[model samples]
Target: MSAPDARPVRGKRPKSGDPVVDRALALLAAFTEEHRALGLVELSRRAGIPRSTASRLAARLQAWGALERDEHGRYVIGLRLFEVASLAPRSHGLREAALPYLEDLHEITRQHVLLAVLDQGAALLVERLSTLGAVQVAYRVGGRLPLHDTGVGLVLLAFADAAVRAQALSELDSPAAATLRRRLADVRRTGVAVFARRRPAAVSSVAVAVRDGAGRVVAAVSVVVPVDAARPQAYEQVVRATALAVSRALGARPARAE
Candidate 1:
């Protein structure tokens, strides 16, 4: 719910910045959605603090086990943070109900399948199943992805609250953002996202929304196949069927046929 890093100060010199609080959080912020590991110098550079300041703060963090010094002398976020992050309530609940369907879909498709939820203005891939035949997708479980870039990401942003939706759009480029707005409207109307290659070497991704018992789109399910084998109609049918099956499993009844 809160931004990863905030300007909250504990003890401080008033106006400009607090050396203590900023450096502490800066050590933590040194780990990003991408690089979860960093050397002291790299961490210092990423956090915009001096190496000596980073070393001092990092020592305390290591003492508390919030970070650990690795074999190469680089530091990584510790297991304690991961242990705490794993206790997030929404993540615990979503997987319990949606997992069986996710497994079934993965088994059926034999491709890269994903289940993701909207979190903090980005879509987080909470679960993923990759088959041998599947194309190599950039997505990883627990990774944060841009909402306008991936199939599941689009659906989650499409039905998100207005402020979150606005934040998602702001993260996009102007032309791509405009394209996404129109694409989202279509996803809402059609209830599916068929994301195929717009250029060479892109994977074909097809996705659909999954509703909970309350009929809200709590998560999105998607499949990625090789673009060379892309058949929009075929992928669309399989994705819709799997989504409907999953929805019913979650106790969501389909709207009557139009």
Candidate 2:
């Protein structure tokens, strides 16, 4: 018979020597956009570990500076985690190269400007800027959006390596999968993607791919505006220009005239 303290682990065991690593990670995952801080009991419940185990893991994390105590005495993700996360090449590197252009787009348009990259089969928002009256969007920094439903997603899909594209296609329902293939071809031909989003009520986005030194598409830049205010296509040139500028900053040279 199992002892009263035993609790089943939530995820796959880590191959590393520290068997508690996965549990520690699960504790970290317990905090999210909605639940930014938690008490020991709540953290344990959410992480699917015993309270005793949660306390021990939290102690270790707090000691290592991966977690911190809030003024309210709840546990929160720590500065040390941010220090580590800031080094992620896909987000930090691209954001460093894209911020000036993204800020410019926001200042010029006074709208929602975003930068995204393909990550784990989704469009991961790396940065976003919005003006006082800018249209609201569903995405936030660190959030993921569907590659099939967003303008940045289309750009990424159009240029994604065959394996990533194939994996995405295989995950969708047959009809939508077939439709995406057609859209990808159009995006490739035009070098831009424009799409209307129904959420936040009738917003449209225009986006273009940003390439790296080897001319490999590494990220996308986009702007969101009201559908009735202006056609999304109207922003295509500026978005393309911004994306191109960022690509150049990353050491990408323009393609030779055909």
Candidate 3:
């Protein structure tokens, strides 16, 4: 599989001036979705590290199982990282509890189903299930998405703590912030959020929150469909029902019908 967010490593220079740490990170960041495997020269160029440094660090990373060379002597991300990432409580724990419902939803709709939660200031996708003919989306398990632009994100932002909301707003331009505020209000009022985008692909999404026993919104679940095939409104009730079932399984009380 391709690397996740394998963009050029960017930041102010590491304050500690630790060559080992800096070069190690640079090597890891060199892999992206489009450039999954690379030879020494390309890896060094992409990582902005000296060839010698990249070679040294790559050797260490390989020794540690963080990276492995392919048949052509190009490096690829190793399975060890995935093994470690599976221990993350926010994703793994919630995914374990929500998998049955997610499977049911996928079976019923044969579309993309996502489970996500707020991480830092973004929506962190914990799990996703997509069928062969499902609408294409630029999301994957363990990927981070913008808080205001995704269905799961809208639900998460709608129920996020004030501090997280504030942080997200502070980062947006005033116009965008205002639009997000309005959208969040709507999500809160309606108990669900629907989102769509046209640039990348014409797709629509419907999402709802999953609450814990204390009524705290712990996660969001969503479905994505091609715009031409979309019946977002029709999917709303099903998504909400699935979320409620998962929430109840996680110990949340059933809401009295209004």
Candidate 4:
């Protein structure tokens, strides 16, 4: 028998002194929207770990309630992970303050309502609401959107720090760079962003900034509608109203009318 404090020495541990914590995290990261449930073989392949190592690590994760097995014996992400992730102050606090306004907008438009924040040089979608027959969009909660695309991404980029703006601009070609600069200038002047895309489906997004108590643009609220359903401009005013409402809920003062 081992001492109470002694770590388990069972199984053939990796001989290279690999970081077990990172390997464990990799196992968790292997699960995605398209691959929510995975057998041990697929999980090992996706995580790039040896089958035996994966089995050992998976057992530990299961014991900690970070993973669960479905009736089919495939591993699934556990509720304990969500319970922990829900405590992240940024996403949790912002979602709490924005959900009611988001729901109101959703009910009014019956379209996709998005709330996203700047994270890791991209717009991280924190919340989304959609109806049964709403237009399908590629974005999902917890997904990162490009800063140079999407209405919320553009709004966040427009209000981002100068250094971040430069980094994003530097990645574009000369002509595209010039066009984006002009667009960013317009977004800053109007405090709103309108972006349209044709691929997957023709849709337009109208987005406006959400501010925090300190008057900083902390998030963006947007409504996505099919091009044929309504002109993107038609929803601009309502989207702006929703954004302002969410901002007020976050302790931001209302902007004085021009």
In the predicted model 4, the residue pairs found to clash are none
Worst 10-residue lDDT window, candidate 2 = 1-10
Clashes of each: 0, 0, 1, 0
Steric clash pairs (candidate 2) = none
Tens digits of per-residue lDDT for model 2, 1-258:
122455545675456647588889999999988999999888988998878878888999999999999999999999999999999888987898889988888888888998999988999999999776766677899998889889999899889989989998999999989998999998998889898878867888899999999989999999988998777888988898899889999999967430
Question: Tens digits of per-residue lDDT for model 3 on 1-258?
Answer: 232333336685456768668779889889987889999888988997777667888999999888999999999998887788788767897898899999999999888999999988889999999987777788978678898889999999999999988888888899989999989999998989999889689989999999989998999999998888857887998899899988988899967751
Please give the lDDT score at residue 45 for candidate 3: 85
Q: Specify the poorest-scoring 10-residue window by lDDT in model 4.
A: 1-10
Candidate 1 matches the true fold with a TM-score of 0.77
Model 2 score (lDDT): 0.88
Measured by TM-score, the strongest candidate is 2
lDDT comparing candidate 3 with the true structure: 0.87
As a TM-score, model 2 comes out at 0.90
Residues 1-258 of candidate 4 have per-residue lDDT tens digits of: 111322437775646657788889999999988999999988988997767778899999999889999999999999888888898868978999899989999999999999999998999999999887988899999898898889999999999999999999999999999999999999999988999999788889999999999999999999999989888999988999999999899999976861
For model 2, what is the alpha-carbon lDDT of residue 144?
Answer: 89
Identify the runs in model 4 with alpha carbons over 4 angstroms from their true place.
1-18
Order the numbered candidates by lDDT, best leading. Answer: 4, 2, 3, 1
